[model samples]
Target: MLSIVPRHYFLGFIPLAAGAELITVFGVVNKASGIYGLLSIFTGHPITAAQLVLNIISLILLPVFLYALHSVRRQQALPVVAFSYVYFLDMLANLAFTIYFSVTWFRVFDATATAEAGKGTASSLDTASERGLSITIIVLALLFKVYFCFVLFGYARMLVRKAGLRSDNGEGKYMKQLQFIMLAIAPSFWRRGGRRAGKGRMVNTLEEGIEMY
Candidate 1:
């Protein structure tokens, strides 16, 4: 029987786990610095209340993202749905970060001209520091992103090559699409696997081919 969830979904968990770790670190930093208030400034008159909403949203998204990933690993069609959920959560977090930074910069500008600018100036400096930390976390997240794509590419390649082997054909649409996506990332993977060699020979499994290359 065919597995309902692809093996690649399990492979994806590694990167997802890493991304979660980065987000957790980000959340801790936000809590430590009380920059959450800046988020509230955008939403309403009382900044603390607004920050509370933002924190709630972040708290909600983190768990939802993890749950989605878990569902994908366990259920049929769940991977697709889970991927969508995780994607949306990731986008929301990014949007929140952007808003947070913009508010901080605006506060900095406001503070530059006022007698009471000292507090705003300090807050702005802290915001900048926070943004720097977020950037570092984002870089770490990107590392996971690369790994996720690599695993996906490996699985898709396996499917394509398997189809070609059965047909004794030069190439198939699935194989072509896989090659295209892989090429978009690492051209080396495409060049090595998609290159024309002896016809009708079964391509090794994705893992074996990857090892050989």
Candidate 2:
């Protein structure tokens, strides 16, 4: 398993595991609220398929998130590992939805921009700036999610190793694949290199394990 930081730094992975669950719960709530807001404002219109899917997912996972949060707080091994896998898969799903929505938004924006350009109401420079800002936000969000995945999986691995769980015995090959995907998806991660353990220097920080993965 890839180590995001020294083993001792995680304090048995309790804090990170609990924090991950809490963050996910909040995220699900936020998504639910956004969906509700859209529905409220567009009461006469049928909701899009994307919104329906997101609503169902958020509804289904909210209870699961709560259960996982409870279990992780008790330091349960299975739930921690399971939640890590769920979070990783959710990250991929979020990526797919993000791409779909981004493409859809750009298409609609392009049409509006064209119309506004003809009307002399909006400039191409303003459109480009908006696009750039949206893309930047999306990229940053994905990068942060990628790093959080590492932290979560690292914590899960620690828990499994501690509990002597053989359920993850064949995970090494899959983990290599995951690492490859991470590197390919976020090449800019390579530029964030920081301190490393070498020359008798003790490594105990998250930055120290950036290259270790």
Candidate 3:
């Protein structure tokens, strides 16, 4: 049976993620002036440099993402698990850098002062509605990424266990910790507790089990 959800659609963000980073890398490189631009040499940010490296790393992983999407779409455990693992780690690093960027941007008073001054005293910097909308969008994006990562982890676990790949009957330490992190981020992961009843029994974050056939 065909899966109801376009599980492959989750992978659609791959290019956007890569493109955004590529843009940022050049922004930091050329020292362009704007929100897209990173810090200037006079007031450099270590995190901006870190973001450049990670963005390059992400670009290099584009093939891994493609393989993951293909594997997941075909229900192939080997490549799905392999690339999913890599992508999840990449995503964790990405999230950390995102937080770092937000913090660093907040502290960049020179740019903030310049931007505020350009407003010509007509409006305050605090625009509550604009700030609220931005925060909502960011929070939603983060939540979706976390949930999808968890789904990948769970699907891989189900496959490995079903195939009887491990005699020890345990998930790996890294995957376990990653799943735990996801669970902590999303409390609605109640269905995973019932996996003993069946294999591929999804407790949906998106599917609430939507990815399963």
Candidate 4:
């Protein structure tokens, strides 16, 4: 029999792939607009556009991160489990942020654009519709991410339990017993002791009777 890749893995990959494309495509396509828009987010001043390219490239790593994360099949120890959890969180947060930014970038318009276009117009309604669709995509991506997060948690815990239940690869060796200064403390030794005590008392009583005579 042949084994097949499960459906859930495919489902999980889709969102991550979508996010990777969204960020890198825009960041590169609008390179002239300056990737440095992100600098304003960080130090309150925009840096060179060259710096932004790195940020855009970083977003492309999300799918790779997701693939790497999904590849962690087992945790050999408790700390591995913890690491897996943190890894999953980082990946999820990265992907979610990308999805959020993509939605705003493609579906939303600025106040100036909206005001100039005027309300009740076809463009405004189209923007609103696109925003709604983007929101739906975001929600679906979130749900998929949340599901996989729980799956990783459960798998990590299972790995921990399996690790705990595992038998150690211990070596069994025998050595000469140490000769104790004390007598052997086995039950047979105690039984012999009781009999010897009775015999000693009998001998003492006989000696006493002979003296009394």
RMSD to truth, every model: 11.8, 10.6, 11.6, 21.9
Q: Candidate 1: misplaced stretches above 4 Å?
A: 1-47, 72-77, 89-93, 109-213
* Candidate 1 TM-score versus the reference: 0.32
Instruction: Please estimate how well model 4 matches the true structure, expressed as its whole-model Cα lDDT.
Output: 0.45
Best by TM-score: 2
Would you list the clashing residue pairs of candidate 2?
A: none
Single out the weakest 10-residue window by summed lDDT for candidate 4: 174-183
How far does residue 13 in candidate 2 sit from its true spot (Å)?
14
TM-score of 4: 0.39
Candidate 2 or 4, higher lDDT? 2
* TM-score for each candidate, following the candidate numbering: 0.32, 0.66, 0.50, 0.39
Models sorted by TM-score, best on top: 2, 3, 4, 1
lDDT of 1 by residue, 93-169 (tens): 65666567667765764555343445554565665676677667766766554444344334433343433332223
User: Model 4: per-residue lDDT, tens digit, 1-213?
Assistant: 001212223344553323323333432343323334565667777554544654665555445444443344223333334444554655565576666576466644556457657754547667678668877887787666555454444444344345432222212332112111111222122222334755786899999999999
The C-alpha lDDT values of all candidates are 0.46, 0.64, 0.50, 0.45
| Residue 8 miss distance in model 2 (angstroms) | 6.2
Model 2, residue 149: distance off in Å is 2.0
Query: Compared with the true structure, what per-residue lDDT tens digits does model 3 show for residues 1-213?
Result: 112212322345543223323322332333222323233333664445676665556556655555455565565554555654565686687688778776675467446655776976424445445456666887787776665565565565455445543322336887655445433432222233334433433333445546564
